[model samples]
Target: MDLHKPPAGPPAQPPVPASAQPPARTPEGCLVVAIRLPVRIVVLVLVLPVRMAWDALVVAGRFLGDAVLGPLGRALSWLAKALLLWPLIGLWRYVVVPVGKALGWLGHVLLVVPVVWSYRQVLTPLGYGLAWLARGAWAGLAWVYACVLTPAGHAVRWLLKGIGTVLAVVGAGAYTAVAWLVRFLIVVPARWIHAAVLVPTGRAVAWCARGVWRLLALLVTGIGVVLYWTVRILVVLPALALWRWVLAPVGRFLAVLAREVGEALGHAWRIAGRISSAVGRLLGTLFRWIFVEPVRWVYRTVLTPVGHAVRDAVLRPAARAARSVGRAARQALAAARETARQTRADLRRMLFGESLPREAVGRREPSAGETRTLGRSTTALTKD
Candidate 1:
């Protein structure tokens, strides 16, 4: 076998879909077809006007949204931004931001700087001095404990050990006497009563209880068997018989009726749509012919020439007269402005009198006749 070649026997077939497979045709009766035709006809008659009205309402709503609501919504949004949002944004940017920054700087200077300075200059040195004093006190305590308290504690411990030994011998004797008295007075009597009386009584009571429990259990089992049979005969059998003979058949018939009605409604709706569309097209064509065509003809043939004549005969001369008047007015305004300007100049000159002439200043660069070269220096260091 070659490694590169695929090992195959027969080519695989593609699976067929369940929907694409041929359906088993059932026989349809003549009565069903007759009934279906009248039902669909009635449904279509009822649905046609409704479909046309629905389509009209949809068109009207779309027109209203486009022509009225859309621009209104945009204007409202722009007005809100201009009246409310822009001022708030300006206040936040120009007023609030600067105030907040100043507050932050003030807080740092008033609170944080003092806290940091106190911690570094006052508290830190104080803590160190206190820590040094604590260390010295701790050293003195350690010295007292090692030199004075340790020896005193050893002496007390020795004294306590001797006293404890004497008490231990006395306590042992008293404990032995107490044990002897308790055994005879309490423990022996309790053991005897438990073994001799309680054991026999408990056994007799338990045996009687078991017998009563068994009798009750048998009685309960018999009652349960009778109730089970009674319920099966009275309730379960009748319910099962009713479901099998009456209810199931009624449910199947109703399901078949509902399915047929649904299919008929769908078929009627599609036919109604086509009828409504044709009616709408006819009405639209009639409207265009009756109204729009006449208006367009009048505009093209009669009104256009009349409008052009009016523009040429009356409007043109009026516009020319308006332009001439505007030009004359502008010239008069300019002459007035010149008169005012000259009057102001005369008044200023009369008040101040003639101005003094300014003096000439010398040039910083060398003059043409005094040009310096390599042979002659201009600096004081190499003056010639």
Candidate 2:
């Protein structure tokens, strides 16, 4: 009965309070999210056309300004060039070139004029003076030749001829006198001197020879006695003493000297060895750095390429040429050898058609009796 009465009424539910609500979650410690590259790329793509259009507008405006001003700039530049070049060209043509040409002409004029004037004035005067002096000298010489030299020459000739005749006569007389005098004086005196001095000298020499022989005999006897004693006493004893006394000291000194020399040599050798070793090491290092390493590097880096180039461009051709030359030379040599062999055979045949017969050759030889005679003659010559 109650359910039938409430059937027309709606049911109601209870509400939750505000204090029972959960707290909101916050992203304070979370990593920042990044935008996708495609979105950024889309944005860039969207702005790129505008940027391109703006850039194109800016370039067009700059191009218009440049195009408008370009001829003006060129005109200003041309005016400046003209301003500089006109004055420079004018200066060169009017001042520098003309002045240079004038200076060259003036120098040539100065040189030529001075030289010509000097030649004409001073040198001509000096040459005229010299010519006048030479003419005067020639005239004076002619006068002297006519006046003094002619008479002097005649007188000198006369005197010379007279003197020559006199000298000849005197010389002949003197020669005769000298000959006679020399014969008389020299020959007579020489003969007398030879007779006198040689005869006396012969006697004296005979006496001196006897005395000298006696003296030499005494001297030889004394020398022999002295030599015997010296050999027995002085020489032998001194030599023995020298051997006994000096040899030990000499040997000792020599030993010490040899030892010192050996020690010095050893020291020098050691020092030299050390020096040589150090030098060798230094040189080896230097060579390695300067020559060996560089050469190796060049061989690797530079020489390899160069060698390859040479092989390609030069060496291969050279080798091929050499081979060809060698082949040609071999062929030439073969031809020459064949020709030589043929020529030698022809010469041999021309020289000798056939082998000589032994009997004919023997018959060409001398006969046995002739050979025996020749041998006997040779034996006689040998004996003589």
Candidate topping TM-score: 1
> Quick one: best lDDT, which candidate?
1
The lDDT for every candidate, in the order shown, is 0.91, 0.76
Worst 10 residues of 1 by lDDT: 28-37
- Clashing residue pairs in candidate 2 are none
Candidate 1 deviant stretches above 4 angstroms: 1-50, 148-184, 265-270, 339-384
**lDDT, residue 315, candidate 1:** 95
| Cα lDDT of model 2 by residue, 108-130, tens digit | 89898899999998998999899
Residue ranges of candidate 2 with Cα displaced over 4 Å: 1-124, 143-148, 155-193, 196-198, 224-228, 231-384
